[model samples]
Target: MDEKTGEVLGRVVVTQRVGWCADLVSTMARSLISEHWNTSDVGMLASGEDAEGRALPSNAWMALRRLGWGASAPEGVKVNDRIVRMAQEQAGRTLRSAQWRAELTTGVLTSWPADPAKRTADEWVNVRAAVPGGQHLPSSVIKSRTQQIASFARANGRVPADPFELEGAPGVARMLLLSACDGQQATIECREDDPSRVVLRLQLPVRPDPR
Candidate 1:
């Protein structure tokens, strides 16, 4: 049974009276990602574990639903399956992207420098080896990470145990990950009036007032 919507994932199929809208899709994706990121839910999702330490499903959306972090459509705006699917696709992509940073933070924590200001050649190699894909990463990236960790240590008087403890959660950009979404969420087609022109349409979530 699906915990979020209280519906069976495979058995029940409800038809939508209206088609999905690109604007609405964009709105929902933005809202879901923003909500997750702001609440540190993104970090939890990236960790692939709940407070109980149980392993979560590899799929981001499923993990979210399992954690009861599932999102909903905008109030007064009805959404269809395709719309929800698209939002899920965008959220999944964002969550997956965070895994890299999580691994990087863990690597840095495991290979903490004797001196953040100066990492010896051997220290450099150790840190690189500890991190996944660290060999290809630029020196600036690791240096920046070390600086962050150093700052945390200075303020707290103790090194953070992990990414969650170090940064709580990573922030995500507020844009639709259109490339990550399925064709049902967005599409591109040539304009009939002008062959040179093309139309790229996708959905977006609504944002509350800045105030």
Candidate 2:
């Protein structure tokens, strides 16, 4: 059984009616270690009587402890159904290009523009006036801002240039522009018949689990 995924990777069934010995043998077999000891040797070991009617070897006691006091041992080690489905569901989210970019853009939609060149000082002031908590122009700027914006649009399901222009509306432009500003590969093109209209194209990665 896979502890993380809760998938039953294997199973073991014992028909014996013996008590502690049966449980111990089943557990050891499930753990893939039964072949190491002979059946007669195990019975003698479990008898609990040593030379002069004293206790058995200390090694046997230690082995029992290592097996987790019988019941506490790993569940799959004996039954193979130990891991529940819920355990697998708790693993970290899968790293997906589209999902990752979409999350980033969603965050960007809530943030103010951080670039000075792409956003004029007056524009920044106007935005701040409209959205009181909006962020102002960043002190340092990058020359690849346009490229980054294009890439983000492509990765997040949109055309780069148009995504920037689409958010040009009063207080939302900064957020949209910032979303397009990082970690993606994108391309921008203007309509042949209408130079005023721009098209942003993006490329998204395929998801492994279509469901």
Candidate 3:
């Protein structure tokens, strides 16, 4: 509480449904991707800025590469393939064509090229097929959460991009914390007074923000 204003500050609470730590995995993945892009670009898409100079609409290419994803370029796809394809298909063929190609790449990367409204359980299976892992979370869930955070970044001009930077009551926060967000981290611990009942304790990291 702020003594001067007698107002409460930010607070959050939620149930984990299961002690799966899905949220922790998610936040950490984003942080790793942001950090990877800060110093290096993984050449996942030949159409990206890394070496092949391929244009893409979003930062998802970075995320995919951080996950160690792999894919094969289709036959006949050439240098700057998305951009070239768009220009070849468009009669007017201007700078807007580049935009079209970017959108195309984003769409393909975001979904398994499946319509979102019509996606089913098979999508996760399909993702596992491509991502070199067993099925975990649904592809839609990851995409939607990313979009939610991206929207927050655009509106608030800030988003929590790292969990290692967060600090709170030291061991307490880190031991039980499952999801850390918005300069905050949370953990689930059995209540001391009532060990049978579980409570979520949200905390602000004890460390200073890194600029």
Candidate 4:
């Protein structure tokens, strides 16, 4: 095949699909001709070895180098399909590796979304684990913490103002309060709206160290 014109030359038969052949030809043309070809010239010269008899202008020669000889022209024109295929394959591999690296950095394990929300399965797992009683944390620990909070509220005869009302009890609310408190006084206030629900509010001093 001729890289410039993408025309098969001589009797060298190839079993590859025509599209593959075109890809091969295009690769070779980009590498060998596109960089050097002149854009202004539009004419092609007849294929012959007699430079003096059929010498093309410098600009025409550049275009001709990119175009190769036309389909009806004679033999001896050459194209390296092996090199073309190798270059195309290498380019494909490089692109795939780049995509893989991007996915790895973003924590996308698989291409398909496991949930209807279009999030990956691993992402859903992490989100669930972050929740108070999700599988990511021990169920016993979560239950015990909740029970401690209920007991403390019952004993105080008033719901503790904030999640820290349970004192040392380690629950999601306690974790949040601890993280927000910086060795300063914090207040938790609770208002009972009904038997089933209670509204809780927290107040902390503006200064980092209220002491």
Could you say which candidate leads in TM-score?
1
Worst lDDT run of 10 residues, candidate 1, spans 11-20
> Considering every candidate listed, which one attains the maximal lDDT?
1
Q: How close is candidate 1 to the true structure, as a TM-score?
A: 0.58
- TM-score versus the correct structure, for each prediction: 0.58, 0.18, 0.20, 0.18
| Clash count of each predicted structure | 11, 6, 8, 3
Over 76-113, each residue of candidate 3 has an lDDT whose tens digit, in order, gives 42223222222221211111223332332233234442
Q: What C-alpha lDDT do the candidate models reach, one value each? A: 0.67, 0.32, 0.34, 0.33
Ranking by TM-score: 1, 3, 2, 4
Superpose all Cα atoms of candidate 2 onto the true structure and report the RMSD in Å to 1 decimal. 29.5
lDDT of 1 by residue, 87-190 (tens): 66667667667667878988988988888999999999999999999899999999998999999999999987667577653443434445545666568889
Model 2 alpha-carbon drift over 4 Å, by segment = 1-104, 107-117, 122-148, 152-211
Ranking of predictions according to lDDT:
1, 3, 4, 2
- Model 3 steric clash pairs: 47-54, 48-54, 167-205, 167-206, 168-206, 176-187, 177-186, 177-187
List where candidate 1 sits over 4 angstroms from the true fold.
Answer: 1-69, 74-77, 168-188, 199-211
Of the candidates numbered 3 and 4, which has the greater TM-score value? 3
Encode model 2's per-residue lDDT on 53-138: one tens digit a residue. Answer: 65543443233333322322343332211111111111101111123233232333333355523656665454445432334423
lDDT of 4: 0.33
